[model samples]
Target: MNDTATPLLDVRDLCVRYETSGASSWRRHLTTVLRDVTFRIGAGETYGLVGESGSGKSTTGRAILRLADIGGGAITFDGQDVATMGRRTPLAYRRDVQAVYQDPGASLNPRHHVGRAVTDALRRHGLGSAAERRARAEEVFVQVGLTADHLTRYPSEMSGGQLQRVAIARALVLNPRLIVCDEAVSALDLSTQSQIINLLMDVQEQTGVSYLFITHDLGVVRHVSHRVGVLRAGELVEQGETKALFEAPLHEYTRSLIAASPASHPQGRDERRAARQARRRAGVGAA
Candidate 1:
């Protein structure tokens, strides 16, 4: 519900499909991973996509990052169509839109020190000289709560949270306008998750970078996202401002999702469950 005239990233009527084959002699299938999905993220805004596993949340993120097979629709960034970008435009687009995935250890090379992994993007894009790149890496490392000394360590030397911070620093070094955070905080413990989420908010405030946060945790979405979209069976079932959607979700699926969240107090779980059942019954009776 951003009133901004031009959003930083806009996705409309998006569809994605994967070609699969069964064990049969001649059987092939086209499975739709995402269908008619639409949403927008403005400058410095966080748009959260939440759903259960296989709900297409990660597929949507991949499509936005141009890593998936786009079956239909348009993904526009800064008023430019991503699908149609030619030659050097895609590289520029990648520079503007970076990604941070769930497994930081897998993302970072074990052989190289974290410093090289962080400044690799800068070197690829020819951003600055070695000294400048090192300075930028140190600054970003500090920004994400890491110290200068930690940069010399390899992925094996750091904790899970620290490695994730290094991943975020890598994305930040590019100074991108949009970041596709695919389950970026799901792997951490509760305390570390809170720290990372707060760090992301602080980074946004400092850099005005937008986020497309994809995760299955509704509670995390509520804490980090400005707007929330609920995906069910590859389709967007609900989308609205986070507070409003959590306070009173219009979709039955969304209501059930909220009721299922672990954040619900144990004492009130049954009451919330009953209320959700009643709502489902009322809708069915009315229909």
Candidate 2:
């Protein structure tokens, strides 16, 4: 869908399942989490995957990060079959693909200095000497709007926004081609969320990196994504360019989601509320 010469990430008919415990230990059932999920992200592009809870949005990101087992289909990254990659993922791939989770504080160890998060990643990849790694860490910290001095502080010493910036620096230090942002901004306040979203866009413009942004916040998706995908019950119900999808969604589920998203301004609050009430009375998208 990106129409790039070659997409940075391509997922086709991806299927993921997990075995659930049944009535007895000897009996188990396989529950499919993703079914025929497909999408593509190009270099420097942001693809927003949006859905409510249990919609398989995060599962898709996990599959791409190689943290989840793929039950079927193919995931090709930069022309390589990621799904077929053996249990031991390549170090190059590890460096090329990184993740920034929702809880930045939890992502960093409470015992270690915040700087260690970036330095440790560099050390694992054998990128540079200790001095070089430290310097690189400082540079990326500044890039994410944090001072080099802040790196010496512990996670508990910083605010949520600051911690999130540190997490972004850690992911950026690897110079990754793509980053899976799993609800990366959902934990922050409105102002902080806007700042982080802008920071990500600036970083992409400067680095040509791709993003697979998985979140339940449609407002954030509309603000940050170039393209959007709506997932329901482990399947993609609709996907298209951001403007078109938001303005004229084709699928019933997609329309319902858009209608349910809080309006950006107060100008049409009463009108929108009345429309929702009408839809509810008609038994449309009822909970």
Candidate 3:
């Protein structure tokens, strides 16, 4: 919405690599995971990063959070460089830039009550007394469309959707400026995913928090993203307004991705069947 101001998060020429080793000496090689990726997310904007698995989409999110070791590039948050943050400074950064992972079941501690998990950040940051943290935790729970009473339950006791709402509450408890939603809805069923996506957008609208929403689902991306960026093998081949890009994808890879989405069209199913039949006929003739 506010296009005049500086971006809340800026990433420039980010590159990441991993080392692989063979059985013999001197056989090791470096595999590039992300290559010269650049993007910016303004305050309250949802920037969707969509790609197939192993496309380095998740790695990019981790790199912004400093979970991955970067080979090169600059990641700046609110004009300050995040990659160069000192050990203790990252704690502060964590407060401002939180994350909700794909699996809330895994992200939450089964041993702890959901209330404690939500309040942990407030406690660790020394924001308030135990009673204050508890009260604030309940407020966030309500904000994320959960009853404060649910906070008494453990992660395992809650359904997948309920657990995810709690996970979102944990992120909201911190009042973060940017939340890296790394496939945050992918694990849920379609109806639940829709609920989560709507909740995320609602939260963003209310709090003005930005999201770096990473997912393999182009249809979901189209629904939630203000802008879309398509990554192939770590390279951001196309980035544009979501509607424009989806209506007329510029890149071949981007077009293929949209076409491959099973939700794209009913006609696509017939086309696929026809293609399969054609392939079979061609094989028979060749034989």
Candidate 4:
């Protein structure tokens, strides 16, 4: 676990709304999709938001990136609140907070070369000279396990795993402080998923960057996350240190998820969970 006391990123009471059809107008009947979701990530910490489809994990990530409108609450990154960021400040925020989407093919522009796509953010952030950006793009390709020859290829030319690697390479190019990986590995095969997980851990070891890993895979979370947050129906139901939460959960929904997980056992699991939570809370009380 990270020993750092101060959080690198802090999200508080964040809410997002999407406007569907309404009686007043097209924009008037706004639906609150995500409600008061909150969590924290420290520097070099990997936090996973685990939930099924339509659980609001993507909405939370998008809200922080300002891709979704913030209906309420604060997203603090590097000690600055993003919800309150001015136009001039958002440019810098983009340099620090990058995103990787689930579908690599859809995320990449088919018209652009792999190298061009990877260097787009570098150019936008004005990281270096043209030659430097080109060189770095090629370097990041290797860093993400892609070959140097891929510089000229398009997203359509690569396999799903390769496409995802390119997406990761592109996110890494900017050296962002935090990366919101929105179901980033869900489309890959299991073997490829392991490779990506190893790559992420390796990158974090080399650089102090943290990750906001959003996924439905509980097994993946068990392996990669230092902390985990469970979201259901647009609300954060439970969150704690990964080991602590997995070993001892306080919420019924969390227990239900554990039971349904492939890794769970059928023998006295509910009783075990109850005992664990009781012991944990007792220990906390003693402390």
Best model per TM-score = 2
lDDT value, residue 190 of candidate 2: 89
Candidate 2: C-alpha lDDT: 0.90
Q: Show where candidate 4 strays beyond 4 Å.
A: 1-4, 23-27, 86-89, 264-287
What lDDT is obtained when candidate 1 is compared to the true structure? 0.87
lDDT of 3: 0.87
lDDT values of the candidates?
A: 0.87, 0.90, 0.87, 0.83
**Per-residue lDDT value at 229 in model 1:** 95
Candidate 3 local lDDT, 103-179, one digit each (tens)? 88886777989888888879898899989999999899998889989989988789999988988998999899999
Candidate number that wins on TM-score, 1 or 3: 1
Worst 10-residue lDDT window for candidate 2 reads: 264-273
Taking the tens digit of each residue's C-alpha lDDT, what string does model 4 give over 1-287?
45457788989999888978766564467788888988889988899899888999888888877788888988888788888864445677887888889897886788988788877778887789999998999888998888889989988798988888898899899888999988888788878887887788778877888999998878777777889999999999999987799889999999888777776222122343466578787785311
* TM-score for each model: 0.89, 0.91, 0.88, 0.86
246-286 per-residue lDDT for model 2 (tens digits): 88999999999999999642212234446668889998962
Residue 102 lDDT, candidate 1, scale 0-100: 95
Q: Could you tell me the C-alpha RMSD of candidate 3 in Å?
A: 11.3
Winner on lDDT between 2 and 4 is 2
| Most lDDT-accurate candidate | 2
- Runs of candidate 1 with Cα error greater than 4 angstroms are 23-25, 86-89, 264-287
